[model samples]
Target chain A: MKRIRTAVQIIFTIFTNGYAYGFLRGKIYQGNLKYACVPGLNCYSCPGAVGSCPLGALQALLNRRGFQVPFAMLGFFFLFGSLFGRFICGWLCPFGLVQDLLHKIPLSRKRKRLPFHHILKYGKYVVLICLVGAGSLFLFGGFAKVPAFCKYLCPSGTLFGALPLLASNEALRDQAGGLFSWKLGILIVLLILSVKVYRPFCQYLCPLGAIYGWFNRFSLVQVHWEKERCISCGACQRACPVDLAPEEISRSAECIRCGKCAAACPEGCLHFSKKPGPNPDTKPDLKPEKRT
Target chain B: MNVMNQWNQKGGSRQHGSRGWLFGLLVGAAFLCIGGIRGELAVIWQKAVMICMECIGIG
Candidate 1:
């Protein structure tokens, strides 16, 4: 099933990316399924998407079209975030899988993020403000365009989401201007570096990751461990793809709850419980690990 | 004794959890807001939300 899902992931990503890049990135796909909601970070602009992407929907809502709150998208994210946290970052995201593959190269010189990068992570907020603030202004301004995020920054949309589609569509290619070129160049750099740098986009610039990460600590889905049961061997922390210290914040919103930590626990000390479950997401072992 | 201790522990846990959550939330939210403001992370959030939804679904 995992292998099949992985294959499905690739197929959906490649297909959607082809269509998004070639045919419908800047333009919305008129197809019903394309406008329908899909689960992962597939672009709404991609021709294969049936529903709109929540981020795109959020940006659209940030613009305050007809006074809608993007309830579907917002609720969707909340329900998902509250349940799985960063689990999405692990098993599902096409981009994430891409980064994992990149990390497979053994010869790359690895570098831990700089101390100042903690500050740099804040840059995603600026990106959000500019996109949402400016995008909303389209209501009154003459320069209204597709939300800036899609146009400027998203590598998934550019490389895996948009470029393939654009390559097949002459109209899109002919229409390719400075903006498209600029977005493409950005994607090229990020894609090339993601393997070496360990999801630089997610670590540094992903506004969505930032948002979901905020809710990770309190989200209903959480990881709890019996610290007393823990041998302090550090296996869970070492298994984390993001290099986060899982033992420190097993329930951390920054944690995708990928279960890698639990899977890696040599002592079988780490266990997960649902929020409605007993005092989970903690390092204490009182009675037992009650499965939520 | 057990009830009193549980209450105290709960209080302490809430306090600590709130602090950790607040710190993470503030930092993460700040990054998101800043990224949104800069217009660089427009699409990442949408895709992320969708991915989060699917994650919870299958998870």
Candidate 2:
């Protein structure tokens, strides 16, 4: 079963993200595979997306001034996050899988976990506010628009989004300047980090993951625990990829609901449920008067 | 540790024991193969979304 599921995952990642589409980009704009995520973080600007990426849409909305907020993209992010939490980060996000693949290099450790994580986890929100704020300032035509996040940050956009654009249009590459250079530097830093760490972006820097985490507590989709049966062996906590103590906050809003905890559970106590919990406080009716 | 031991013992309804994953994989593979075969972009996206949903811990 695990092998089959893994194979399915491999095949889907191959086709959906346009690992195939990159081979076909720019030859024709209307290729059949253009709809896929187009593996390796291809840019939305390459022009094959039937539906725009949430980040691209967010950038577009922020760069236009009619709305005080980028509400449409915000709503989409919330809806996706609410439905799956960081599950998208785990299973579907094309870039996330990239980070995961990079983090698996063999490295001996005197200590397995990092000693310092004091403030890095908040990087994504910083990415969110700083870039959005800067872009908003330039949108009024008093200044020309530059996608600040795409320019100064966002390794995915640099590696996946910009390369394809550069390859396809000589004009765009010729027009590029320090902004493109800046994104390349960010991508380089991210590449070095990915080699050493286990998904630093998702851990401390993915605004998408942060947004989704807000909804994990209330989403219909959930990790349900039978607390009554919990023995506290600590397997679930260790199995968690995000380093969350799964037993303490088994269904925590921050949890992406990844099954590593369940898979690690020698006990069958952890499972997904449409309803949120095996609520410990609730009691079943045992009233004698009901017999009357 | 004791609570976990109890959990290990507290079996409830019988699980199908991983058949669900098998079924999901077959369905997902079918979507991928079919999408590849027919060149239906919309169908490819829809199937991709569905596969991602199940592969997601939730379902």
Candidate 3:
């Protein structure tokens, strides 16, 4: 299952960023497909990206000269959130793939949870509300629009868009200034942290993750937990990459549905289901089966 | 009677959940069409094609 997910991630990454010429020439794809938004944190400015970043599009629309609402981008978010929730993060996002790969590197101590993990989880919501929402809408100077999150904090843009563009284009390299340095520093720190911590960005900082998380409870696909089959063992929680106890918080907003918990369950209590209800065969009074 | 009531309640909730999902899809589609009619897709295209220096954190 993990291998299948990795293959899907790699395939989707390539499919979304398949413009070979763009990478060679240090130019973004200027085709009509750029108008369509991908359901992940890909940067539109990426040399090989064929679709727009939904967060970037939202900010751009909000920062437009007039006070026009970004109805289409909101709709895009709504549709994707309702359908997949953070399953996109687990299986589609290129940066998530990057972090997943980075976390596999040999480390003395790989921490499952970061410092202040509980308090820090709310930071992404703050970013969603402030940087992506209000900062783009209200903090722009007259006649100039600002994509606050993309401009100030997005490491994905720095890694996939800026670094590649600068690598090929000497003019863009020369144009790099303090802002570029700052964003690059952020990228480096996040990448380094990824080696030790599991998906620091997704757990704490991604506005896109925060958006998708809101739909976890009602999304079309979900990690369903059969309460009757749970044996009170903590194996699922221990195996969870993001430290969520799937048996207790079956519909938790923070669950990315990576199936780590499901994979770890010895009793087959946790499973993915399309329908939002208890198992038809559930026997509430059934005894917990002992696992060999 | 109690078991029947519980089963009926579960069935109703499941039906409600499906309805909510369909309603969400409909709402999303409606807003998408409205935005397209208002030329939002073109606006997105214009922004995306242009090299957003700020987005790259270069400026």
Clashing pairs in 3: none
Q: What's the distance in Å from true for residue B23, model 2?
A: 30
lDDT of each: 0.55, 0.51, 0.84
TM-score chain B for all models. Answer: 0.38, 0.38, 0.67
What C-alpha lDDT, on a 0 to 100 scale, does residue A177 get in candidate 3? 94
User: Could you tell me how far off, in angstroms, the CA of residue A45 lies in candidate 3 after the best superposition?
Assistant: 0.6
TM-score of 3: 0.91
Candidate 2 regions with alpha-carbon error over 4 angstroms:
A1-12, A19-22, A25-42, A46-50, A108-114, A137-142, A167-171, A248-253, A277-292, B1-59
Tens-place lDDT digits, model 1, residues B9-56: 575444544344444444545544554454424333344334221111
Fnat across every predicted model, in order: 0.01, 0.04, 0.61
Better of 2 and 3 by TM-score: 3
Using Cα atoms, each model's DockQ against the true complex is 0.05, 0.04, 0.39
Instruction: Judging by lDDT, tell me the better candidate of 1 and 3.
Output: 3
Clash counts for the predictions, in order: 46, 12, 0
lDDT at A28 for candidate 2?
A: 19
Instruction: Fill in the DockQ of model 2.
Output: 0.04
Q: Candidate 3 residues A60-142, lDDT tens each?
A: 88988778888998788778888887899999999999999999999748998788998999999999999999889878645
Which candidate number would show the highest TM-score if scored against the true structure? 3
